[model samples]
Target: MSRASRLLTLLQMLRGKSRPVTAATLASELEVSERTLYRDIAELTALGAPIYGEAGIGYVLRSGLFLPPLMLNADETEAVVLGLRYVDQRGDEELSKAAADAMAKIAAVLAPRPRTHCAIRPCCPARRATASPTTRCRSMCSARRSAFRPRC
Candidate 1:
Protein backbone atom coordinates (compact mmCIF):
# COMPACT_ATOMS: atom_id res chain seq x y z
CA MET A 1 0.00 0.00 0.00
CA SER A 2 1.06 3.60 -0.50
CA ARG A 3 2.44 5.51 2.47
CA ALA A 4 -0.62 7.70 2.59
CA SER A 5 -2.93 4.69 2.58
CA ARG A 6 -0.81 2.97 5.21
CA LEU A 7 -0.97 6.03 7.42
CA LEU A 8 -4.72 6.11 7.11
CA THR A 9 -4.97 2.41 7.96
CA LEU A 10 -2.75 2.92 10.96
CA LEU A 11 -4.93 5.72 12.20
CA GLN A 12 -8.01 3.56 11.75
CA MET A 13 -6.43 0.70 13.67
CA LEU A 14 -5.50 2.98 16.50
CA ARG A 15 -8.94 4.52 16.58
CA GLY A 16 -10.57 1.09 16.76
CA LYS A 17 -8.84 0.24 20.02
CA SER A 18 -9.90 1.62 23.41
CA ARG A 19 -6.80 0.52 25.30
CA PRO A 20 -3.16 0.89 24.33
CA VAL A 21 -1.89 -1.39 21.54
CA THR A 22 1.55 -2.96 21.69
CA ALA A 23 4.07 -2.25 18.90
CA ALA A 24 4.52 -5.94 18.04
CA THR A 25 0.77 -6.43 17.65
CA LEU A 26 0.42 -3.31 15.51
CA ALA A 27 3.38 -4.35 13.35
CA SER A 28 1.93 -7.82 12.92
CA GLU A 29 -1.42 -6.44 11.84
CA LEU A 30 0.16 -3.89 9.47
CA GLU A 31 2.77 -6.39 8.20
CA VAL A 32 5.60 -3.99 9.06
CA SER A 33 8.64 -4.21 11.31
CA GLU A 34 8.60 -2.88 14.87
CA ARG A 35 11.02 -0.15 13.89
CA THR A 36 8.87 0.86 10.93
CA LEU A 37 5.77 0.97 13.13
CA TYR A 38 7.61 3.24 15.58
CA ARG A 39 8.62 5.55 12.74
CA ASP A 40 5.07 5.61 11.43
CA ILE A 41 3.73 6.40 14.88
CA ALA A 42 6.25 9.24 15.18
CA GLU A 43 5.26 10.63 11.79
CA LEU A 44 1.55 10.39 12.64
CA THR A 45 2.21 12.12 15.97
CA ALA A 46 4.11 14.94 14.24
CA LEU A 47 1.19 15.37 11.89
CA GLY A 48 -1.09 15.95 14.93
CA ALA A 49 -2.62 12.49 15.29
CA PRO A 50 -2.60 12.67 19.12
CA ILE A 51 -0.96 9.21 19.40
CA TYR A 52 0.58 8.79 22.83
CA GLY A 53 3.02 6.03 23.86
CA GLU A 54 6.67 4.98 24.25
CA ALA A 55 8.90 2.13 23.07
CA GLY A 56 8.43 -1.25 24.90
CA ILE A 57 5.16 0.21 26.20
CA GLY A 58 1.95 0.56 24.12
CA TYR A 59 0.36 3.41 22.21
CA VAL A 60 -3.10 4.91 22.61
CA LEU A 61 -4.93 7.52 20.63
CA ARG A 62 -6.50 10.24 22.75
CA SER A 63 -10.29 10.35 22.69
CA GLY A 64 -12.11 12.88 20.50
CA LEU A 65 -9.22 13.84 18.26
CA PHE A 66 -10.68 14.38 14.82
CA LEU A 67 -8.61 13.26 11.88
CA PRO A 68 -8.12 15.15 8.63
CA PRO A 69 -10.55 15.02 5.73
CA LEU A 70 -10.79 11.46 4.45
CA MET A 71 -11.18 10.25 0.91
CA LEU A 72 -14.55 8.65 0.24
CA ASN A 73 -14.67 4.93 -0.51
CA ALA A 74 -16.18 3.73 -3.79
CA ASP A 75 -19.52 2.79 -2.25
CA GLU A 76 -19.88 6.07 -0.34
CA THR A 77 -18.98 8.12 -3.41
CA GLU A 78 -21.51 6.23 -5.54
CA ALA A 79 -24.27 6.68 -2.95
CA VAL A 80 -23.72 10.45 -2.77
CA VAL A 81 -23.69 10.78 -6.55
CA LEU A 82 -26.85 8.71 -6.95
CA GLY A 83 -28.68 10.58 -4.19
CA LEU A 84 -27.74 13.94 -5.72
CA ARG A 85 -28.88 12.80 -9.14
CA TYR A 86 -32.22 11.75 -7.72
CA VAL A 87 -32.67 15.12 -6.04
CA ASP A 88 -31.76 16.95 -9.25
CA GLN A 89 -34.36 14.93 -11.16
CA ARG A 90 -37.29 15.09 -8.73
CA GLY A 91 -36.90 18.25 -6.62
CA ASP A 92 -37.93 21.88 -7.14
CA GLU A 93 -35.73 24.28 -9.14
CA GLU A 94 -34.01 25.71 -6.08
CA LEU A 95 -33.50 22.27 -4.55
CA SER A 96 -32.10 20.92 -7.82
CA LYS A 97 -29.60 23.77 -7.94
CA ALA A 98 -28.59 23.07 -4.35
CA ALA A 99 -28.07 19.40 -5.19
CA ALA A 100 -25.92 20.36 -8.13
CA ASP A 101 -23.76 22.58 -5.93
CA ALA A 102 -23.41 19.80 -3.36
CA MET A 103 -22.34 17.40 -6.11
CA ALA A 104 -19.67 19.85 -7.27
CA LYS A 105 -18.30 20.10 -3.74
CA ILE A 106 -18.12 16.32 -3.46
CA ALA A 107 -16.42 16.05 -6.84
CA ALA A 108 -13.81 18.61 -5.84
CA VAL A 109 -12.57 16.35 -3.01
CA LEU A 110 -12.58 13.04 -4.93
CA ALA A 111 -9.50 11.48 -6.50
CA PRO A 112 -9.54 10.15 -10.06
CA ARG A 113 -10.53 6.58 -9.18
CA PRO A 114 -13.41 7.54 -6.87
CA ARG A 115 -14.47 10.23 -9.37
CA THR A 116 -14.87 7.55 -12.02
CA HIS A 117 -16.96 5.51 -9.62
CA CYS A 118 -19.15 8.51 -8.98
CA ALA A 119 -19.70 8.95 -12.73
CA ILE A 120 -21.33 5.53 -13.07
CA ARG A 121 -25.08 5.86 -13.50
CA PRO A 122 -27.21 4.43 -10.73
CA CYS A 123 -30.08 2.09 -11.71
CA CYS A 124 -33.14 3.94 -10.52
CA PRO A 125 -36.39 2.88 -12.15
CA ALA A 126 -38.74 5.45 -13.62
CA ARG A 127 -41.60 6.71 -11.44
CA ARG A 128 -44.76 4.64 -11.75
CA ALA A 129 -47.87 6.09 -13.40
CA THR A 130 -50.58 7.40 -11.06
CA ALA A 131 -54.14 6.00 -11.12
CA SER A 132 -55.64 9.32 -12.29
CA PRO A 133 -54.55 12.44 -14.11
CA THR A 134 -52.91 14.91 -11.74
CA THR A 135 -52.27 18.65 -11.89
CA ARG A 136 -49.06 20.22 -10.67
CA CYS A 137 -49.56 21.63 -7.17
CA ARG A 138 -48.32 25.03 -6.11
CA SER A 139 -45.46 25.24 -3.60
CA MET A 140 -47.96 26.15 -0.86
CA CYS A 141 -51.54 25.12 -1.65
CA SER A 142 -54.25 25.75 0.95
CA ALA A 143 -57.66 23.98 1.26
CA ARG A 144 -59.39 27.23 0.21
CA ARG A 145 -57.28 27.53 -2.94
CA SER A 146 -57.42 23.87 -4.08
CA ALA A 147 -59.48 20.66 -3.63
CA PHE A 148 -56.65 18.99 -1.66
CA ARG A 149 -56.22 20.26 1.91
CA PRO A 150 -52.64 20.88 2.99
CA ARG A 151 -51.71 18.51 5.79
CA CYS A 152 -50.38 20.63 8.63
Candidate 2:
Protein backbone atom coordinates (compact mmCIF):
# COMPACT_ATOMS: atom_id res chain seq x y z
CA MET A 1 0.00 0.00 0.00
CA SER A 2 0.98 3.58 -0.51
CA ARG A 3 2.05 5.75 2.41
CA ALA A 4 -1.32 7.47 2.35
CA SER A 5 -3.08 4.13 2.36
CA ARG A 6 -0.91 2.84 5.19
CA LEU A 7 -1.68 5.92 7.22
CA LEU A 8 -5.38 5.45 6.60
CA THR A 9 -5.08 1.83 7.76
CA LEU A 10 -3.43 3.02 10.94
CA LEU A 11 -6.34 5.33 11.61
CA GLN A 12 -8.85 2.53 10.99
CA MET A 13 -7.01 0.20 13.38
CA LEU A 14 -7.05 2.86 16.04
CA ARG A 15 -10.79 3.34 15.54
CA GLY A 16 -11.51 -0.35 16.26
CA LYS A 17 -10.11 -0.35 19.76
CA SER A 18 -11.13 1.69 22.79
CA ARG A 19 -7.50 1.77 23.83
CA PRO A 20 -4.19 2.95 22.46
CA VAL A 21 -2.31 0.69 20.00
CA THR A 22 1.41 0.12 20.07
CA ALA A 23 3.64 1.22 17.21
CA ALA A 24 5.10 -2.26 16.94
CA THR A 25 1.69 -3.83 16.41
CA LEU A 26 0.84 -1.19 13.86
CA ALA A 27 4.10 -1.73 12.02
CA SER A 28 3.60 -5.50 11.92
CA GLU A 29 0.05 -5.19 10.72
CA LEU A 30 0.95 -2.69 8.02
CA GLU A 31 4.14 -4.61 7.06
CA VAL A 32 6.26 -1.59 7.74
CA SER A 33 9.27 -1.04 9.96
CA GLU A 34 8.72 0.57 13.34
CA ARG A 35 10.56 3.65 12.14
CA THR A 36 8.28 3.87 9.13
CA LEU A 37 5.24 3.58 11.34
CA TYR A 38 6.48 6.34 13.57
CA ARG A 39 7.03 8.54 10.56
CA ASP A 40 3.60 7.78 9.25
CA ILE A 41 2.11 8.59 12.64
CA ALA A 42 3.98 11.87 12.60
CA GLU A 43 2.66 12.61 9.15
CA LEU A 44 -0.89 11.93 10.32
CA THR A 45 -0.43 14.15 13.35
CA ALA A 46 0.92 16.91 11.13
CA LEU A 47 -2.18 16.53 9.00
CA GLY A 48 -4.24 17.04 12.15
CA ALA A 49 -5.53 13.54 12.70
CA PRO A 50 -6.34 13.54 16.44
CA ILE A 51 -3.75 10.85 17.33
CA TYR A 52 -2.68 10.70 20.94
CA GLY A 53 0.09 8.63 22.57
CA GLU A 54 3.65 8.57 23.82
CA ALA A 55 6.73 6.34 23.67
CA GLY A 56 6.33 2.75 24.93
CA ILE A 57 2.57 3.25 25.52
CA GLY A 58 0.70 3.55 22.21
CA TYR A 59 -1.58 5.90 20.25
CA VAL A 60 -5.29 6.66 20.09
CA LEU A 61 -7.57 8.79 18.04
CA ARG A 62 -9.73 11.09 20.12
CA SER A 63 -13.28 9.74 19.99
CA GLY A 64 -15.25 12.87 19.15
CA LEU A 65 -13.34 14.36 16.25
CA PHE A 66 -14.90 14.36 12.82
CA LEU A 67 -12.73 12.97 10.04
CA PRO A 68 -13.02 14.33 6.55
CA PRO A 69 -14.57 12.15 3.86
CA LEU A 70 -11.34 12.14 1.92
CA MET A 71 -9.51 10.50 4.79
CA LEU A 72 -11.59 7.34 4.89
CA ASN A 73 -10.47 4.23 2.98
CA ALA A 74 -11.91 0.80 2.19
CA ASP A 75 -10.76 -0.77 5.46
CA GLU A 76 -12.11 2.19 7.35
CA THR A 77 -15.43 1.63 5.61
CA GLU A 78 -15.51 -1.95 6.93
CA ALA A 79 -14.56 -0.73 10.39
CA VAL A 80 -17.55 1.61 10.42
CA VAL A 81 -19.83 -1.18 9.33
CA LEU A 82 -18.47 -3.54 11.99
CA GLY A 83 -18.83 -0.94 14.71
CA LEU A 84 -22.43 -0.23 13.75
CA ARG A 85 -23.20 -3.93 13.60
CA TYR A 86 -21.94 -4.51 17.12
CA VAL A 87 -24.04 -1.60 18.31
CA ASP A 88 -27.11 -2.85 16.45
CA GLN A 89 -26.88 -6.30 17.98
CA ARG A 90 -26.79 -4.99 21.52
CA GLY A 91 -29.23 -2.11 21.17
CA ASP A 92 -32.92 -2.06 22.18
CA GLU A 93 -35.47 -2.02 19.38
CA GLU A 94 -35.39 1.74 19.05
CA LEU A 95 -31.63 1.97 19.20
CA SER A 96 -31.15 -0.99 16.87
CA LYS A 97 -33.33 0.66 14.30
CA ALA A 98 -31.48 3.89 14.88
CA ALA A 99 -28.19 2.16 14.11
CA ALA A 100 -29.63 0.85 10.87
CA ASP A 101 -30.99 4.31 10.15
CA ALA A 102 -27.62 5.89 10.78
CA MET A 103 -26.02 3.48 8.32
CA ALA A 104 -28.62 4.42 5.78
CA LYS A 105 -27.91 8.09 6.30
CA ILE A 106 -24.22 7.47 5.86
CA ALA A 107 -24.95 5.60 2.66
CA ALA A 108 -27.04 8.48 1.42
CA VAL A 109 -24.35 11.01 2.21
CA LEU A 110 -21.51 9.06 0.61
CA ALA A 111 -20.17 10.37 -2.67
CA PRO A 112 -21.68 8.85 -5.74
CA ARG A 113 -20.31 5.68 -7.45
CA PRO A 114 -17.65 3.48 -5.84
CA ARG A 115 -17.63 5.42 -2.62
CA THR A 116 -21.34 4.75 -2.23
CA HIS A 117 -20.75 1.02 -2.46
CA CYS A 118 -18.69 1.22 0.68
CA ALA A 119 -21.98 0.66 2.45
CA ILE A 120 -22.25 -3.05 2.99
CA ARG A 121 -24.04 -5.44 5.34
CA PRO A 122 -22.05 -6.07 8.51
CA CYS A 123 -21.93 -9.79 9.29
CA CYS A 124 -20.64 -9.80 12.84
CA PRO A 125 -22.11 -12.67 14.83
CA ALA A 126 -24.45 -11.15 17.36
CA ARG A 127 -22.86 -11.10 20.78
CA ARG A 128 -24.57 -12.24 23.99
CA ALA A 129 -22.69 -9.71 26.07
CA THR A 130 -24.78 -7.52 28.32
CA ALA A 131 -23.92 -4.00 27.24
CA SER A 132 -25.96 -1.08 25.99
CA PRO A 133 -25.93 -1.16 22.17
CA THR A 134 -28.14 1.88 22.30
CA THR A 135 -25.51 3.88 24.07
CA ARG A 136 -22.77 2.69 21.72
CA CYS A 137 -24.78 3.60 18.66
CA ARG A 138 -25.65 6.98 20.10
CA SER A 139 -22.04 7.71 20.86
CA MET A 140 -20.93 6.60 17.39
CA CYS A 141 -23.65 8.66 15.75
CA SER A 142 -22.64 11.69 17.76
CA ALA A 143 -18.95 11.20 16.93
CA ARG A 144 -19.64 10.71 13.23
CA ARG A 145 -21.67 13.90 13.15
CA SER A 146 -18.95 15.74 14.99
CA ALA A 147 -16.39 14.56 12.43
CA PHE A 148 -18.39 16.08 9.62
CA ARG A 149 -20.08 19.12 11.13
CA PRO A 150 -17.81 21.19 13.27
CA ARG A 151 -18.86 22.32 16.75
CA CYS A 152 -19.99 25.88 17.17
Clashing pairs in model 2, backbone N/Cα/C closer than 3 A:
66-147
For all predicted structures, in order, the TM-scores are 0.43, 0.47
The TM-score leader among the candidates is 2
Regions of model 2 farther than 4 Å from truth: 68-152
Q: Distance from true position, residue 25, model 1, in Å?
A: 0.4
Clash numbers, per candidate: 0, 1
The TM-score measured for candidate 2 stands at 0.47
Predicted candidate 1 versus true structure: per-residue lDDT over 95-150, tens digit per residue = 98787667655553466566554344432334535523232222112211222212
Report the alpha-carbon TM-score of model 1 versus the true structure. 0.43
Model 2 over residues 1-152: C-alpha lDDT tens digits?
98778887787777655578898988998999999998998898899888998888899876446343444565575567666766787778998877776665454334444244334433444333565998666665554443333233
Per-model lDDT: 0.66, 0.66
lDDT for 135 in candidate 2 is 67
